[model samples]
Target: MAKRQLVPTVRLRRLALELRQLREQAGMSREQVADATGMNRATLYRIEVAQAKPQGRTFQALLEVYRVPEARRKELTAILKSAHQQGWLQNTDDLPSQYAALIGFEAEAMRMLNYESLFVPGLLQTENYARAAIAGSAPDMSAEDVESRVIARMERQARREPPQTLKVVLDEAVLRREVGGPTIMREQLRRLLDDSERPDMTVQVIPFSVGAHPGMTGSFVILQFADEDHEIVYLEASTTDLFLESKGDVYRYRRQFDRLCEQAATPEATRDLIASELSGLK
Candidate 1:
C-alpha cells in the first residue's frame, strides 16, 4: 500500500501540477501511463491531485515515458525531493487540513495582501481576540482544540524571519465590533496600532463613508511568492476554502486590491481610527 500524503506542501502541489502537464504534453492518458508503468490509475490520479507523493521510481518512470530531457528530469527530481520534506505544519493535528495549507502558503509567501470585512486577519490577530473568534466560530470544538489552533496561528506569525511584507485593509466594521468584549477589543486595536508601526507591515481602514466597494462580497488574501509565477489567491468561507492560481483569477483579485487601496484610509489615518475606536471602548 502506498503512503498517502495527509498534508501536501506548495512545492509538492507545484510538482504534481508539472507532472500533470507533462502527461498532457505527451498525449498520454492516466490509464495509459498506469498500464505502461504498472502503477494504479487511482495512484496516478492521487499523485496528480497532490494527495499522494510520488516515489522516486514513479517519478523517474513518468519522466522516461514522457521522454523528458535528462537535464529537465534532474531539475524535476530536485523539486520532488524538496517537496517530500515536511513543513512545520505537517505535524499539527488540530487545524483543518485546508487551513493548514494556507499556513504553509503564508510561510513561503514574500508578501501578502489581505482584505477583511468582518474580522481581523489571522496573521495580525492578538491571542485573546483569536481565542474569542475561534471559540465563537467553532462552538463544538474542545477547549484543547481551540487552544491548539490559537497556538498554531501565533506560531505562524512568529515563524517568519525578516518578516514578510504584510499589507492589511480592514472595513470600519471590523474596528467597531467587539470580539472579546471591550477589554480584549481594546488590546486588539492597540496591537494593530503597534503592528502598523513596523516597517514591514501596513494597515489601512475603509470607512463607512466609502459606502459600497469591490470587497463588499467578502474577504480574501492574495499571497505573492518570491517566484512571481507561484502567486495565488485564497478565499476562506465558513464551511470551505478555495485557492485560485490561474493568471486570470490572480489578475482580477490584484486589480480589486488596488481599488481597495484607493478606497482605504492611509496608514497614519488608520492608526488614528484604531486609536479612536480604542478610546471609545472605555
Candidate 2:
C-alpha cells in the first residue's frame, strides 16, 4: 500500500473521485487498471479513496488509460498538480491532524454554514479574543504555540478576491460570554458587527428566547464545495474532530442549519442585538 497523506485536502479527495469515475466510465475495473498501469491494486484503491496521493506519472497513465479527451485530460492534469501542492495550514506542526484537514476544506469551501453555541466562530474572532479563548481552552500551551494557533485562526478570515459566503448563526450565550474580558469581548462584538456588513457574509443570532432547538447539542459547521456532492459536516471536540461526508449525515446537518436560520433572529435584528451588547459594555 502507498503511504497515506497526513492531511488530505478536499481537492485531493475530489481528484481521487474523478479518477475513479473516469476508470468506471472506461468500463475498466480496479484490477485491470492496476495491472495495466504497473501499480499495486491496493495502491490504486488508496489513490481512489484519497488515502494516498497519486504520483504524477501514475496519474497521467491512468488518465491515458481512461482515454480522457484532450481538453479534459489537461484539466485533470492541472488538478493533479494542485493536489500535490501544500495547503496553507499543512506546514503548521502544532495543529492537530484533524484540524489541519478542516483548514484544508475551509480554504476551498464555496459556502460555510456555522452554528456557534459558545464563543464566536474563529473566523470572525478578533485577535485578542482568539488569544484568550485559545489560552483558556489549553492553558498548558506555550505562549509561542498559542500565538501560532491565534495567527492560524485569524488567517482563516483574510479576505479573498471572491470571498466565500459565510452564514453564521450564533447562540445568544456566545455573545454574552466574556472570553477575553470586557475589553476583548467588546472588540470582538464590534468586529462581528463590522464583518456582518460584507456582501458575502450573513450573521444571525439565535436568542435565548428561542429556547429548545436542534443546535442545543453543540456547534458544527457545514461546508459546501463547488462540487455539491462534496458537502461535509465538521464537528470539533476537545479530544477529536469528526468529519461527516455521508450524504445522509450531511443532509441532516443541512436541514438542521436551515431550521436554525429560521429560528434565529434576522441579520438586521442580530446586528441590533450585538449593538445592544456593545452598548452595555460601554
Candidate 3:
C-alpha cells in the first residue's frame, strides 16, 4: 500500500528550513533548542525537518533563541502568521498534511479556478451540507469531531473576502449526484446558484451531452495570487496533494481549465439550469 502522506507546500517547507537554520546559527543542538523552547527533542527535529508544526509559542521561543534580526524576524513571523490561519475545515485532522497546506494556500489565494467532476467544492458548501458531506467521508469520526471539522471549513470560507474572479466548471452529474440525500442536495444546488451570482465569482456546468473533453482526469485548482508571477496548479488524491509551480506545468493546467471553461455552459445559462433543477427538487 502507498504510504499515508503529509505534503507540506514550498512555503511551509521553507519556514521549517528557516527555523532549522536559525537553530544552527544560534549554535544550538536539536536537544538544546528543544529544551529552550520547552518542546520535545523529537518535535524539535520534526520542526527542523519540516515534518511537524511547532506551536506558536514554541516557534516564537526558537526565534528569540536565534536572535533573528528585526527585519528577518518580521518576515519569519509573517510565515508563522499563516500557521495561525484557521479555516472552516481545520477542526479535523483527517486531512493529510499535504491537503492541509492546500487549505492555507486557498486562504491566501486571490483568484481561484476549480473544475470539479464530483461533489460540491468546499469553498462553496453550506454549513449543513458541508457537515453532512464531511461526515459521510469519515464515517468513523466521532460526532463532535465531525462538527468541529465542519465548523472549521465553514469558518474558513467566512474568514476571507470571497475570492476575486473565482471561476468553476462543474459537471452536471455533480449537481445530480444527490450527495447528502435529496434535501441536502437541493440545498447544495441552491447554494451554488447563490454563490455564482456574486459579482466576482462565476460558475458554469458542462452538460452530460458534452461527452469527452479536457479534464477527463479528476479535478484541479489553479490559483492566481496577487503577485501575478506566482500562479500555481494544485492536484489532489485520496493520499497525496501536488502543487505544480514550474511555469510550463502551470501553463498546462491553465490551458486545461480554459478548455473546460469553453466546453461548459455560459455562466448565466448554468445558473438557470441550476435554478430549474432546484425547483424540481422541491
Candidate 4:
C-alpha cells in the first residue's frame, strides 16, 4: 500500500515464504492463483518473492483460494499487516544495499551470535570509538557523511533497549588494535565491560593464546528470530556484504561460531582480561 517496501524486512520475507508455501500446499500454481484472484501473474510473483506487498483484498483472496485454516489465516494476516509498516534503515538509499540489509536483519534478531576477529562488535561500540573508527577507516569521507554513519551506528544500539540477547566472541587483537588511540580504547573497553555485565549480553574474548582458530577467517554474525526457526548468517566486507540463508551456509557458520565460543575465555576471565587491557592503555 505504501509504495510497496523498497527493501522487504525479515518479517515481510518470512510472510512471502509462507505465502508461496501456502499456495503450493493448496496445489495452485501462480497462474491458477492469479486467475482465481484476478491479479496479474507478475504482481503475484512479486508478492511471493517479497518485492511487493499485497493489498488486504488480494491477501484475503489468496487465503480463500488456498483454504487456509482460520487460525493460520489470522496469523498470516497479522504478519501481512505489519510487514508493510516502515522500519529503521529499511529504505536507506544512502547506504550500500548490503549494509542496509544487515540493519534490517539485526533489528529483528531476537538473539545474535557475533564472532569478531578484528574489531569491537559494531552494536557495542561507544560513540567516540565509532567516530574514530569510521573516520580513520575512510579518511576521504566528508565530515557530514562521517557523522551520519556514526549516528546510524549509535541508533543501532536501540535493539538492546530491553537488552537484546547478544553473545559476542572477540579476538584479543580487537582490544589491542588502538582504533582511536589510548583514551578512546579505554572508554571502549569499559563499555564492553559494562555491556558484558548485562543479563542478556554475554561477551567472551579469545585470548592470543588460542592462536589460529576458526574465527581468524573474519567476522560474522548469526541472527535468530523468535518467530522463525531458521537462522541467517551475515558477513560484512570492504567491498560487499553477504547474507546466507541456505541451510548449509547457515550450518557451517553456526559450527564455526560454536567453536569460537568454545575457544573464548569464560565471562569472568573476559572481565579480568578487559581490566588488564584497560590498565595497559598507557
Candidate 5:
C-alpha cells in the first residue's frame, strides 16, 4: 500500500474513480485482483478508496491486472506523479483545512464559475479590500493572522494556473457594499473592470431588479476539471466548508449557476455598473 495523507487530492480522487471503473470493466472483483496480483485485498481496497496513495509498483500491478492500454497507462501515471505534490496552500498554516482544500480545488480546476452575493470574489479583490474584508469577517483573528490570510489570497490571484477561464456573477449589492472605505472599494471596482477586459474573464451582475435569483441562497464555486469526469461544487461558510461531489448535488449547483448566469447582466452592462459604483465612491 502507498503512504496515506490527511486529505486526498483531486488527482487522487480521479485516479480512484478511474481505477474502480477499470476494475469493473475488466469484470474482476477485488478478491480476484488481489489473488491475481498476489497482493492483499485490504491494500487493494485502500487504493481503490483513496485511503492510500497508489505507489508506482502498486499501479504497475493494477495496469497489468486490468490490461490497460499504453496510452491510458501513461495518463494514469501522470496523475500518480502529480498526486505526490503538495497542495497549493503550502506556506499558509493559518488557513483552515477545509479552506486549504478550496485553494487546492481552485489550483486544479480547468474552469471555474463563481457567484457572490455579498462581496467581490476573493480572486478579484484588491489587497486593501481583502484585508478589510478579512478583518471585518474574522474579528477574532489577530492582526497577524488577518495579514497572513490577505497575503495568501493575493498569492492565489497571482497563480497563473490552468484555470485560464473564469466566469463571475455578482449581485448589485456587492458593488454598493463598503469594504475598507471608499478608496479601497474604488480600487477594487477598477480592478474588476480591468480584469473583465481579459479574453478569458467573464463578469456579470445581477441587479436589484432581478429579484431573488438562484444564488440568493448563498455563494458557491463550480469547479470543472478537464482531466477527469470529476466535478466539485464548493460552498463556503464562516467556519467549515462543503465540497459537494455527488452527481445529484453537483448537478443541482451547476443548474443553479446556469440560472444565475441567465439572470445576470451582460459583461458590457456589468462594466457599466462597476463604473457607476466607482463614480459613487469617494
Candidate 6:
C-alpha cells in the first residue's frame, strides 16, 4: 500500500473555507468580523483565504468571533499548526523573505497562471538563468546564496505531475530583454518553447505590436486551487508583495487576465513568436 502524502495546503485551504463559511452562515461581512474581533479586515482576509499563516492567538480570536464550536476548534487548530510546520525551504534563507511563503504555496498549487512583464517566471528559470538574475539584482549576495536560491527554484519544477494547468503570458519585452546576454537569453527562450510543448502547459506572448495591454500595470500571478475556494492574486513591486484574495479583487484580476489574453497572440502564434525570437538571438 502506498503511503499517504501530507499536503498541508489541503488542510489550510480547508480551514480557510471553513472560516469563510462560518462568517457567511452568520450573515456577517468581513468588516463585521473585524469589528467583532478587533482584527484588521486585511488580516482577516488573509487568514480566511489561507494566504497568510495566522498566529495561534489570531486564529483563536477568529474562531471566537466566528462562533466556531469547541468540538471542531481543536481539529482546525491542529490542522493549522501542522500546515505551518510543512516548510520545505526552512533551512534555505537565501531566497527573499517575502518569497518563502509564496514558494511553499506554489508547491501546492494545482493551477498557476503567471504573467511576466519583465523577466522569466521563477518556476521556469534554469539554474544558470536563476543565478544570473539573482546575482545581477543583489550584487551583495554571496555565490553560495545565489546557488541555494537556484536549487530552490529548480526543486519547484520537479513535480510528480506537471501542474494541472500552467498558463504563462510573457510580454514581448521580456523576450527581448537580455537578462543574461544573448546566449543565455536564447537558451531561455528555447527552454520556454520546450516547456510549452508539455500537455499541461500553455504559453502566450503579448506582442510588442499590441502596444499596451491589461498587464501593463505590473506582473501578477493568479493561482487557482482545485477545491473551488476563492482565487488568489499575487502582486509584486520593487520592495513589497501583495496577496489579494478578496472576491471582488480576484474578479478584477480575472478580467485583466481576460483582456491580456485577448490582446496577446494565440497560443499557436505565441509559439511561433518565441521561435522567431529564438532565431533572432542566434
Off by over 4 Å in 6: 1-98
**Candidate 1 at residue 16, lDDT?**
75
Instruction: Write model 6 residue lDDT over 6-86, tens digit each, in one string.
Output: 332534665666677678988899998899888899988887777767788888888888788897798678767766442
- Residue 153, model 3, lDDT: 81
Residue range with the least summed lDDT across 10 consecutive positions in model 5: 86-95
Give the TM-scores of the predictions, in the order they appear.
Answer: 0.70, 0.70, 0.68, 0.70, 0.70, 0.67
Considering only N, C-alpha and C atoms within 3 Å, which residue pairs clash in candidate 5? none
Global lDDT of each candidate: 0.84, 0.82, 0.76, 0.82, 0.82, 0.76
Best-performing candidate as measured by lDDT: 1
On a 0 to 1 TM-score scale, where does candidate 6 land against the true structure?
A: 0.67
* lDDT value, residue 233 of candidate 2: 80
Clashes of each: 0, 0, 6, 0, 0, 0
Tens-place lDDT per residue, model 5, 55-78, is: 789889999999999997997897
Q: Which of 2 and 6 is ahead in TM-score?
A: 2
Clashes of 4: 0
Q: For model 5, what is the alpha-carbon lDDT of residue 240?
A: 52
Task: Please report the TM-score between candidate 3 and the true structure.
Answer: 0.68
Candidate 1, residues 114-172: lDDT per residue as tens digits? 99999999888999999999999889989998999899989988976555899999999
lDDT-superior candidate, 3 or 5: 5
Tens digit of per-residue lDDT, candidate 2, span 80-195 = 77774532222234245445456666776889999999989999898999999999988988999899888888777773325578899999999999888899999999999999
Clashes of 2: 0
